[model samples]
Target: MVHVVLTGFMATGKTEVGRRLARILACPFMDIDSLVEVAAGRTVAEIFANEGEPCSIPRTAAAWPRPGPSCASRPDRKRFSGGWGTPRAGRSWRTRTAHQIGLRASRRCSPSAHLRMPLPPMRSTLPSSASTTSSSACAGSWRDGDGVQVVEAEARVTAEGAVQEVEVGLGPRSYSIVIGAGLLPGVGTRLASLGLHGRAAVVTSERIGALYREPIVESLRAAGFHPTAVEFPDGEEHKNLAWLAVLYDRLLEAGLERRSLVVAVGGGVVTDLAGFAAATLLRGLPMALVPTTLVGQVDAAIGGKTGMNHVLGKNLIGAFHQPRVVIADVDVLRTLPRREFIAGLSETIKYGIIRDAALFRHLEERLSEVLELRRDLLVGLVAACCRHKATVVGDDEREEGGGRMVLNFGHTMGHALEALTDYRRFLHGEAVAIGMVAAARVSRALGRCGSETVGRLERLLKRAGLPTEIPGGMTPTALALAMQTDKKSVDGRIRFVCVEEIGRTSFVELTAQEIVNHL
Candidate 1:
């Protein structure tokens, strides 16, 4: 299923366009900002005036992960279907048990997986007969005196399961990230709808290919495309110029051309190497991503940045090549090793720290469920991370401006540690866990954050079974030297991301001496 996501600066007609598009497609329309305003019991201008713009409504919207029934203060329990309702006095929006709404697909719709919108619409403008109630918020319908009822739309779930869609709005480069369980089998049918034809190259690691190759190849063959499987050794150590050269040789041997599609099906390592190859080989080839690991699904595969680690630093040699689509099958994550799964949490934690404080709280509250891979919680977590990533990537596709730099929350020391260890001692996420600690410490020392912030981060990382400190026998001096060669460094000064608080960060340049002082 395809979702049209409208995003831009304020007063950009995103809401109007979204409403019109929804009418044309006969789908539900949601305006997040309007929901925020209703929840706050104030207008957008008032919210901006009372609180800073940064603390305004959108942040509240980002916190919501799913749509459910909402409760209002009205005593009447009358339910209305497919129409507007009037608001009652002293009505306050609150969450209640979810009510099922069955929506039949229009003739224009195509058959595939069920499409669901995790976030439902909020209350809009009210009528004069109803008195305003104190500020409260909910996820579903809102009623007013003018016989206007605002009903939230729910996604259709089949006997199989439900599919959640997140839009990465890059204008012409935009694509949909489909997250759900058991999606790999239908990948072929989905690809066919995207206008892709000709041969397909599936780049994956030997380890992962052994488990998933047959299903993907079978799916492609069922969709009337010839798929060639290319396997490489699995490890960050193997992500180098030599392996890249090998992939190029393999693709050329397969008679791949510009019209052919490159399918990257593995963890972050495979995605980086394969995406880089697709970007450089034949100038560029259309690419699709199927990220298997938690790290890949939530972080690596969604962003357009693709590259292999350089001897000097991680991801130093790469290109900005966006994929045509990303299909994240949660079922595949069940095969991930425990350690790798824990490592992925580091990136998840990074997302919470950089933005989405509510996500951080959710992780803190549901760490056990997340670790156990509860389908409901895990799906929402993945969708939230993707939304955060899509927003950043849409704003800065190239990372030339500082907007995208916030994503490098912990990577300065993280990449340095990886290079210093020669990519052998620690997993990419492990090194990043340590790097985040170092960054938080620096932020505290520079008075950007309080000491409690550092402590909270250390405890969270530790709880996630991650290393929050430089490993024993590893010298800080070596890490500093490696950081000097980091891709983000300029004029020999290492640029660092400083955390002002959880969900708030800024970029700062620090000298080698100053970095050590924070440690």
Candidate 2:
């Protein structure tokens, strides 16, 4: 077998992604980290520090070179090569000049320089670059701040229009989050393919249901499902113990079972209540989350993690229950107000920060359409994010160690903010916006993150219509109390997840005051 190995500094999702790609390719995916751990009798961290890259890189490279056609004989063909970041101005100029000066240099010394520019902070888009040579057009996205994102979309003019699909794969349980203007017309039919049969419940808030209920209900009926629509009250205040009981009662009254399915159609609160109910009822039932808003589509629906909030804190009453499918209908976003759309962007930006730096770039270029809620782009944007979240979720399944926590890039202060606001003043995505700003500040305090990172995240938040700072009239004490009970933390230290640089992050334990001081 020709083994293809993936390498990066660390926590670049090599092991998790490699395994899944291997499965798709029908090949054995080996974990280099695990192998090194066993061989050197140490952890990846230990090996890097003790043996260093000078020794480790060669050892890793030595693991390659399977029996294949030698490069000497097949010099015309090339396998693969890719890289990241920028170069020192003078150094890059010299290399490019050298290539142009010598004819033989192109073969002997092929040089690619991705100059260091202020890229979109993890989660949004890179700024418009007239001079930047990205590996591919619309390569990635970067976060500007709170709800603000700079989405870069690449285009090359030609006779025939080319359609580049941005997508998300959740293994067999996967569904699409297409962001194109053409996606909304028949989403219910697309969802039915995953198996919504004679009976299905449409769980959403009354406010949201009022707007788009008819088409969805009709769609479900057309798909042969005995559709029943249930709309709870709107707002996070309703996402609590009392609301869940109502849903459970409604299901019972309808005589639903594990065989039947629950289709959550709305924002985060709707999905959380519906998903939690689906996870617990009959020891688990099939769920197809049709996230309407950006927040629901990008952040809430894809991840298996779901729960109603306790009076004490946000997401404290939750479970790690994977959905059978997540259909993020981007068309629903058109119905949303600008602020609501921005809230969704907040979560999308989170995906960029926690995972792909490239996603940030896409947002930068397409900021206008995204802000305008251009229906055409919604499906692709949502799908790209769904793929991002689904990939992490499939690998972790359960938040064991640091596997799933990466998804909580801004939730540390986010949850606390929601709790402090009584879950009414700010939407979940809005809270995340403020939370990310706070986290960036804390990162700066630790001497890890730079000022530019803070500015990028902050700007995105504003553009997305989210708050950058805590709301007025809230006590720092209540916020601190909320942080103490954050579900992701342990030993009551309020462990915050911080990104040292773009495309990388680390979990660090911090005190409530530490977070408060930044605020």
* Candidate that scores best on TM-score: 1
For residues 34-133, what per-residue lDDT tens digits would candidate 1 score against the true structure?
6566777776556656665445434454423242244233222221111011122111221132222222222122111112212123333234312222
lDDT for model 2 comes to 0.63
TM-score of 1: 0.71
Candidate 2 C-alpha lDDT tens digits along 132-200:
331222212333332212232322100011112323454665544433333444656766776557777
Provide the TM-score for each candidate, comma-separated.
Answer: 0.71, 0.66
Model 1: worst 10 consecutive residues (lDDT sum) = 81-90
Q: Which candidate achieves the best lDDT against the true structure? A: 1
Clashes of 1: 7
Regions of candidate 2 where Cα sits further than 4 Å from its true position: 1-188
* Model 1 spans with C-alpha error above 4 angstroms: 1-161
